[model samples]
Target chain A: MAQSNFDRRRINGPEESFQPTFEDDDDRETRWKPGNPRIGRGARDIRPIFLTAGLINQANGSAYIETEKTKIACAVYGPRQSKSTTYNEKGRLNVEVKFSPFSCTRRRVPIRDAEDRSVAVQIQQALVPAVRLELLPKSTIDIFITIIENDGIEGCIAAGSVAASAALADAGIEMLGLVASCSAAVVGKEIWLDPTEEEGKASSGTLILAGMPALGTITSVWQSGSMTPADGIKCMEACQERYTDIHAVIAQSLLDNAQNNT
Target chain B: MAAVLLSKSERAYIQSSLKATPPLRADGRGLLDFRTVLLETGVAPLANGSARLNIGKMAREGGGGTEIVAAAKLEVEDVESGDGVDGGRVACSVTCSPAAYPHLSSNALDELQHDLSVILQQTIGHPSLHPRNLTIIPRKKSWLLNLDAVVLADAGNVVDALFMAARAALWDAKVPRTRAVQYRAPEALKSAKNDVPGAMDVDEGTSGFDTRDMARTAADFELPDYWDEGETLDGREKWPVCVTLNLLTPRHFLDATPAEEASVPQRLHLMFSFVPSAPPTLQAMRLLGPEELDLKDLKESIAFGEQYAKELFTALETKLREEDNRRNIKARDRFALMR
Candidate 1:
């Protein structure tokens, strides 16, 4: 069989393999799906919650999280002044996503290019609604997310948003409540939670939502691909369920961090 | 954030601080002390391989603030002729993203990037073996290796931080394989026939020599006759480390932090390559300042840089060899499983 574009890109020697392009369907789907079955879970029960507090020494508060396959490091920089004058009504949040040159399966070219900007916008849109921007007018909290490793897109965006929130809280950013995000995808009539990159690409639809479960308000809702209204609702329900679990983890992480610092 | 201009008093105070101890600082470290240097390789999961280095005050931070992360990504492409005369060439590029230091301007970052790239090429690029030697496979197809360095936090001493990061990156780099076929030109074959007057008479008795025979002969003429299949071509590049010396007062420091660098009147950066059992080669050196350094200071800095380079090269080689051994063991286990 002819090699799939994803396989071809993945096996193109070690260097190029680091920056594998997500343009191909296979690459997109596989990378977006949950853990690979080949790895057989790897004693998940013995694994840590993949959470630790106070990782970013420079930031006010920071955290490092690694799920079975996904790894994310988030640093929260400040409640400092907003750089621009237009966004003065409320505190502004700037989100930046940087994939290290070797982050993917191909050698990623490090440039301030368009891709970085788009991802920044995606993250910003997902986060601004969740943050209590009006609380600290004229100030800004910068969330820097470095995706050390990505297993799938399903829960990643949500996980990353939650991680950002934890870092923000660690930084002492006041907010209405902790915002946790999670994703669910409809794969061949099955609702898979945190689908891997591969399963996500093959799924009929994906829904990513970030909210403060305690407040019962959805801050961000992003849906892609095709899905019936019922499917969307079901995915949203799945996301909410996942969010509750993730939110508890975030709360615990913040408490643990506070205790450690003391 | 708006820039904070250093007042004259601040600058003078820093200068005085350097001269107060006559080369020894309040930290109990000598003027030239590099602090404790620690390097960890293959830490970043997303990267092919990455390294983190902490030096000077940063090392004191205990892997916290002021750390540098350098990653190497290998790429293969049709070797272009301008890449040089060599068959296969490896090129490295280093960029420092001081996102943590938003006060740093783009222009300043660009200058540092250029400086780092030049240092890497001088230290690692081989005019004889790299691109030049790879050229034998034709420029149409070749592999290029790129190394990127990112500064996660900047407490100070970027040069030492960058150098250590780059060293770990180079040690972690793995180049892909390339196979080459050699054959004699038709004109050369015709010339060989003309040179041998009795060649036609013995043509029937002796086997005809085609391009493959010429290639075989050329291969045999070289040092080793049998090609070592399954042998890794990794880790062949020469190791070179760049040393940056800050000229402060009448004294010279091996590495200086951002604050120390700002206070200095002049700085000298030297790139040197040290191959084992051979004399060290000065790959490139540049002196920077508004005023030229006196001959005495220049000599002192050169001597310091050379000595530092020797120690650095030896330490790095030992580390690389150990890592290589671990990798070989891993490969052997995987191979055994396949059987």
Candidate 2:
């Protein structure tokens, strides 16, 4: 890792373009599919999602989630005293997300790069409203997420959100409902759900939606690049449709953890 | 840096104290008194010039010192004729350590860096610092001085400490000297200009004497060669140092620490440079923080600043001289060791 002369903390340089030789380079020539655009998978289908809670004993609550190649672990500590406490009726939520150095194809510098900070902010926006913060007045809840592996930027973020929700639940914090996120990449006119790292790079636009299924309310939505309003609504619909399946997996994981505890 | 959280009573006490006839500050200093600063030059071995500055609170105030480290490095780059003035260019960058200012969000850090850089460029970019003929060759090559300041700690009044360190580092900077050669276009070439579509047809390159054209010629036209020992920047006496005043409603305070800065709603930053032979000049002033001020109050603040700036200018001049003398003695001792 590179270090600044004045400070020992690692600082990343400009990112290099991702280019790797693949044996099936000619097979998937374009991002859009005439029939099935996905790489050996259904176009509308998502990769397998796995969730487990209470993996970290040190934290009040912890959870781990893996969505195909994207793996994230989250730890929930403190409803503890806030470091900089002021007069506030509601508890403060502090969210920080970091990626491991070898999480992606390229070796990352061990620092909170710009992208990490951005993703952390997105997560904060999504979780702040979902948590019953008024229940823990004048306190602070600290959530730290670490990505162990990342196959796509959107997929990794979605995985982080799911892990955080499960972690909060495991810690026995009150919440309206579980928050789950789904991401889709817009390639030409086609919408590909859970696009791989390569497919994401080829996308013209991307949409990520996080919502609490029980309350039928969206906590946060992020969209970038080019997408029509109709396309955005369709993407959101697709994301909402997947919430049930994600909820079932998370519930099963918690149940299994309780059974194992005995 | 985490701002000291004053209770409702503490806030009330300070506000009322500021409004009192004697106007005693929370730290018990007069409005004009600045925190004590410890400055040392040549702390960085690799840089052309460097300074480390620390502003310590009074013993009664009871806290750690705020530290700022600054370094100046000189590089050279070529420019084309017809560009502009061939003076040395100054670029500044400021970064704050996350450990020192844990309360500052990343977005706040970015904004602070931008504000400091803009002030540094505006204050140091005066043409007087780099006279028209300073470059070796017009538009060929000129000195590019980069001044970088890092705030290792943020007690209060970070901008002032950064400016003080940068001013000292700039005084210590030395730029490499160069030689220039004047070239006259051939008469036949001048005549041939009509054949070329975009060439200038007017013969009086000397006529009209547009000062802008002269500056362009100074920067882009003639070229300079570097072969001699480096030269120090001229008109050192005219270089400026910034003084910041934190305005809290009815009262104004100078050299505010982080806790003090958080309590105030507005700040006025003034750049004052002194020429020994004349009265000190207020080069520029900028108001920061999110508060509107009445025009009359702003004018009054600037007037008050002018008076204090004169005194500060004298103190800085004395300190600079003392540092220069100590650096010279160190250099002589090193030379004697070589002998």
Candidate 3:
């Protein structure tokens, strides 16, 4: 019976579905044209953050972060017994990112796609440097990220990284410092911080940078699309400034959560 | 990378030596140097294009390097009007051979495969080349290029080696030129008597019938024979090649060996596409391993990638040209024997 493929408990959608196309159906109004200025903000400005911690009582530590249209929920569990009972010198960190079926403009099935895995890998790289894994040897820490609503893929991931670190801190796990993240897109000559999906689609390049502000160290950097080296450097510099602001918000939320707990 | 283990003293020694000014690698090479690579193309005859690349395989040595093979298969299929096929489509998959790691469990291998496949698909499978090259008819039929890569050997830096093999395969690829023909059913065809596929041949050469008059619905592609007529992908020079920078504290190197990789804690994988007489543009980048990214030398690190990509592209192009000449000479000799 175990040989039977697929899970029985979950209802499976069609094996495949294609996006329907119609001639002269270009949604020009919603699409951001290239070489245009930032619609509502300056080239180097980022969206305001709405962050909260300790939202889920069931999770060891949980946090939710929202920036404009993108929303991410992160939960951290363990430093508990690992499934593999082999002797280990350092703890194992498992990071998983999933998209809700209705998170994006198009429906996402329960299946985990390549984008989800790529983000998971990026988040793992960002947080692994800060976590004090050697102290919790032979254990495992699991971080689960869920995208409830999505705008741009890079934006969701940057927000998700911040929420993940907050959740880990809320769980009372010891770490060198909290890792904060920021993302931006280069549209024509302008760099739009926290670009929406439309701007990201039309942008020349995308940069996702995450780091620890206290330690002044970058933990991860992922840049996709195409741009010259000069634009990349400028883009990274802009994201670094925004990373600190985002980290400040997380610190304030943790402060508020701490005061309320007492 | 963990297959080769070194003592603590050895690891530290390698790291410190690499940090020295004009840093030295254990293999008697400069810090930015890559191990010599032996590249061969046209390995898979059944596929449209294929390549096999062996890196760090020194002369008179018995299998002391990483080897990878990549193949691109082409299939023509009907597409809906104004559908996704406008740019044609490229699907990519990468798998690790179990033989490469007999000691590792299947789960670990699967994870590595998934990681490599995702990165490759994001960089190479995305549209960099114009799609009209593969489209035989607008909004009707197009060629689907399915690229598959296998890691035959694993010495170290398999990701870099895999991307190189994929690039070479794509470089050696030949897409059989195709002509579109529309079928006009005979006036008495309501009886559904004749269903000869695609309706005609390319040898007919658009002589008499006006293919432009037929509706798009009845159009189909006729593939060319391999005897003579075919075309290589255009603007392949603009295709990106991956360059990895292995970080060892103050110094970073390109195309690290297994021993060099174990001592290093972080790396930057950069993909770049360059054309003649213009600045090279970045395609994608990812920081791997568990360490802080070195921000001080970020600009210089990218410059290294740009320079390395230009050199590697030149090498790849020269090898492909030689292969083409050899094939042509062989063809001439074969035709001479026809007497």
Candidate 4:
């Protein structure tokens, strides 16, 4: 992985259009419904994605992504010798997640809590299948994800994977294919794609998955709460459908960088 | 990691830079121009009274390279014994955290704190405006004002920067009103005697009253009913400013930036107050350097520091008073709500 110096220059910008919400609002009875007119909609509101490649100068590769409301930064370090020698046949990947002290409304304490650790583990599980770890034996590539700001869990893990993959590619790390991740929540019988914080909280079920479109392989699978196996299959299908849009974004981010460098 | 060593030539170049300019250095201002100082109070949301000051950033002309931030925290405490007969005391501590220089020693912090304390004690605690006046209750309790100064970034001339921050923080500090409730004592109640309604005064021809007893009664019973009013009192504490003098070669600078500081061999720090309408008060003074300064240098530095100290105090007072007026207007709006 090659470290990029551009990341350090972009600090948290002036506060505007940032909203803080507590709890999810995705239940069937909730006054606000997903895709409702009250929520408003636009490419500017939902698109206008800000993406940057090669930020962490010390890391092999790094990228920062900011959607309408969410901001995620990822850095990939190494391909260096692995610390744990036991996994000698295949290379290893480790993921770490961090939130800035001022990332949230309330001061975020430095200590990593159970929730954060779980997210890190889940993210690692999601990306493992997409990365070609066996290409470099006895080596390890570390991914550090820092959530500068969070809007909603919708597309967060997928966004994180895209950032991680871009950073890894920038570092010149070999990968079987790019993995894209996204999530959907089932609130009551209704399936909501890209649930906001309010919707995610009210959701009775959540499905997070990652897959390599080129290879047609599912790299990660995660489900929480209660959802039928049929519902799970439906959500995965929806995710695959969403992948086309996410793939374009990942592709454009790299293309823009290539053009800028040229 | 091997330490990056400074060669002899590098040290000599730095020393030569110090001598390149004569007294009343390059900016054409006197030895005490003090670079344009900008002070703003109540900047820190969390602190009681926080201040951010930029000292000497103007000297860079258009470069805009140097900047410093100093914040002050003011806290109140009870007056301790042996601190005169005053019921309360105010402690002002200033910490300069230079973003440019992160690894500062504890000794440096202590030196800055001591200088600030002196300046505050002298001007704010002048003999006429005694700190004891701030005491709501005598002997038993008093308000102790604690001021903490923090330096957010270091541009140059931290002493001036620190002083500005300290002054702003002090202005921002609001000494809460202290109220005391005292129940009437049984003995005091017993001392009250009822006078007959519509009773006539005694004269020489009638029943006589002793003149000596009348005098004693007058002395003991005057305003006896409102004795409690005098028992508890509240007032504002005085404000003070810290002054630092940097000795560069044979020339003396009032506030020196980090670059200028690195060139200087010694520093003389003093905390003093001059209330223009009143006599100057000297609180604390210290000469910081490996080498000792002669009495003449000490006296000259003191004079130079005192002159700037007065100017800083006036500027701070005006700024604080303006803030107080703004607050009063807001308070009046709040009072309107009660009706």
Candidate 5:
């Protein structure tokens, strides 16, 4: 079946959409042969990030983060009474990631698509280890992320984990440490950290890693594509190196918000 | 996959027993051992290739073993319209039989299906897959292989069974050979048409080919009537298979039962290509559970997963070959009887 499930609640876009074709298509294929510098930046550099917490008025806690062209807003709903009829010992953590219809090159449907659900699962796994669900038994913490703009799938997921974790901290939930995530595209022999959609198109492999920088523990690892063991380790290590920086951004913003409240 | 439930006493017994060196699994298998798997290919007659696998049960009529049926189907379409950004692609979906898993909520079942399908889809996107071989016409037409699986039963480590069945199905899958390909309109490649076993069915002059603009061309291809003469998917043997390692702290084991899974604090699922090398290509890896994995365990799990994947691939290869031989013998016997 070709997309049998559509969101009847909202007016849908066309069933098919195509990426715009360019004039210089023939020569473009040979443009990215290894060892050449990326179009605008060094391979090791990531887009400058802007992050903050506690923005939403109705939600328990909220955070918004922007990285170049990508924008993500996250909100944490509750650790209050769960709606489940059955009894649960350890609290439940639910993560939902949604991309706006116009967020990516192709128009996403109003309903949750596979890309959004996959990212949501990754974010939940990344933050589960850090969230002390047992302390809030019989309750559930729901995390929702809205992507206004998506630069790359891997980048969006890594950023979503960071934003979700920061929002959880802002909600005053007890936790081990913040989960900082980063991703990179393995293009040729080089590793481009926090690759954008354009850079990601030519890469052979992609890796997104989430870790607790303070606790020095890995919370989640989602990697795909083809790569040697050495390259996989290299990509993982590259991601680990940047977590402290990303964590610092989240931690500093949280500190700034706390001081302003006082 | 909803979490299996166990009593505190059972959990404690399993945890304490498994934490020791040379950990004793509930099934009495060694650390690097796999549960017995019984698989039969060509189980689905209409599909290109299919396999039904039963793990944790030796008797065919047994009731408790985890069972799964996997099928790989192929369809040809224009490359630009295909969902794949690079080349031909594999689309995977899984559904858990409610008869087997009555306890799982609808939401849990949806989530489980998505996760299982993602692992299969991403693993097949490995560079070694060589999807370009699916090209019927360069940059124009390619094959899209749709892989679907049904989890009939989940004994314990059902994901392993699912992965094995999928790999075997693709292993036995065949691609229809394009005897002749006519790229756009009236200019049918006359030279390539005479060698085919079937009469050519070409759509005449729907559009004409312009040598100056070959990029926007459409292709018409015909498959031979004899399906057995078809070719296998390119680089089928090098495709990766998943090996899930359950960590009970201090020691890890190959396949964990439902009771054993409930006691385990963490699991590491690694997908490795069955290439014969010191370190096989790591197609994909994911960590599941509530605790952080130690570096030692992560490293050990990779090496362990690689070794295990190779062995498992070997076992599957032999099984497929044996099944082929059996089919050939039966076909020959029928031919002699008819003659």
Candidate 6:
């Protein structure tokens, strides 16, 4: 019989269709081992990274960075007049971070979810210290980062920090030093450096650190899950070491860009 | 719409310049010349279509350069049965960053959002421009187009950048293909279902429309496999692009910066969409400020707007073509490397 088209659920399907099942079903005890070749190398090795600056022509300064699994692009516009009337002597840095609806493994709603907003605020705090905002008064610099694809939340933030810093540098904004970041995932006794989506999901804890290696100042540190104080310190040290590597990559990228431009 | 407070002397300078035979703007551009535009599409990889446009380059010394980013995503969903329901829906939203205008009041922001939404809808949402066949399955399903725009920087002439970026994004958008199934009842039973006492008593007069057709055919409808191809919107060229002019009594300027906009007392927004075999037609026009111009001035502004719109359209087409070519080359190179 022909049915009326009135007030029908758009697509007829279960509210939650497919259940998530982990591909690695190895015994939990054997999942991560201190000396196992794969587990040991996985905890210390980072995916190859790519970084570029001045890619977004519209933005005063722009940078694009990508790892094997994570991709982020950032644009910096301003040092222009600020919209607020508060008489702040220092320049204001406004940071906004967004994940595209299709950026995650599962499609997300386009709206800025709580998680996105929180990350944005965290990023803003991490970046503020590195920028020499007192150089420009009554102006605000806007930094926007879009996570095109996210392999791990920690990795995304770290990459976004570096990219935003590069964009700031590209925009010719004064800064004390470039901020570089890295994340490590802790599973049992093993701390995996630059965890991919799979490793992040299986890990018990994550440690993310942002710092200006040259200035020896840690700009921001973020942690999720639980770990002993000893384990946390070790993870942080590993992240600091990784930051040096990232800083070199960024320095080289900016130098190459300058050479190409000239 | 002076975004910033202008002092008396600066205001006087602009007024005197406008009163001249040919208006000489502070930046010294001709009255009809638009700000230099730099637009790039496909900037946001995860979006179906995306574009970033800068109305003016960031000035090295002074305040200038309004930047906008726009993204368009299309989703297939059930639409109510109606005359134009098959043509699909377009929802456009504009959000300004607090950095755009430091002291922008919430009331002003809300008003700007409303005006932009209304103008964009009127410009891009023509039934003929978005055909039913492009995204419709009668009463079963249709496409809902969500067009979101964010103002990255507000140096001035935000409407122009927003509209241009929106048009570029839409031009780059693609709609996925879908297959629909129809369920037909047996002849004898069909008449009974249609003639049932309460069946005919449905809301309004639309009794024959099957709202549950999709639900009933849910099991039978063969959805597209992963390998199936998607479709781009038809009649995309008919989608309108906007051109806003700041009319300060006797003087009219195209693409006014915030400083210039503040000096003006009147502003007019015009949208034009090209016809297949005819000249571009005015799709919509609105006066933003309280002061209105005389009929003669209005006529002259329309003519200028139309001419400038054609130039912008040609420039956009060329840019899109160049972008497509570059994208194709990149893909080809990657494919070659893999092989």
Among all candidates shown, the one with the greatest DockQ: 3
Please give, for residues B1-339, the per-residue lDDT of candidate 4 as tens digits.
001234557556655655565543434556566667666656766655566666655544653423434343333343333332345665555444434445545654544444444444433443333334445455444555555655555555555555556556655654445455454335543334324555455453244553433332211111234312232112222344666677764667666655455555567655544445646644434344323333345546656767778787777677767776665666678878988
Worst 10 residues of 4 chain B by lDDT: B215-224
Each prediction's Cα RMSD? 23.1, 17.4, 6.3, 26.5, 6.0, 24.3
Q: What TM-score does model 6 achieve against the real structure? A: 0.49
Q: Name the better of 2 and 3 by TM-score.
A: 3
Q: Pairs clashing in candidate 3?
A: none
User: What lDDT does the true structure give each of the candidates?
Assistant: 0.61, 0.72, 0.82, 0.58, 0.81, 0.73
Cα lDDT for residue A246, candidate 1: 79
Residue B34 Cα positional deviation in candidate 1, in Å, after optimal superposition: 1.1
Q: Which stretches of candidate 5 lie over 4 Å from their true place?
A: A1-3, A14-31, B78-87, B126-130, B181-219, B276-279, B329-338
lDDT of 5 by residue, B1-339 (tens): 457778989999988878766577676888777778889988998888889998888456556788999998987877666654335767788888877678887888887888888877777745546555677766667777888999988888887888888888888788888755544434356556655778667654454753524633545667768837478887777767788888766677877878888888888888777655545677788898898875545666777777788788788888988987766677789888999
| Model 4 spans > 4 angstroms off | A1-262, B1-31, B44-48, B57-86, B94-100, B104-130, B184-238, B325-339
Which runs of model 2 end up more than 4 angstroms from their true locations? A1-262, B1-9, B57-63, B81-85, B126-134, B179-229, B329-339
In terms of lDDT, the poorest run of 10 residues in model 2 chain B is B215-224
- How far residue A2's Cα lies from its native spot in candidate 4, in Å, is 50
Q: What tens digits encode model 1's per-residue C-alpha lDDT throughout B54-158?
A: 765443445544578887665445534233323455666666676745776787666556655654553455442232322224445554556677767665666
DockQ of 6: 0.01
Q: Which scores higher on TM-score, 4 or 5?
A: 5
**Interface Cα RMSD in Å, per prediction:** 28.6, 20.2, 1.5, 34.9, 1.9, 27.5
- lDDT for each residue of candidate 6 in B1-55, tens digit (9 for 90 to 100): 4257887689788878877887687778888788778888889877778899988
DockQ of predictions, in order shown:
0.01, 0.01, 0.69, 0.01, 0.65, 0.01
lDDT of 4: 0.58
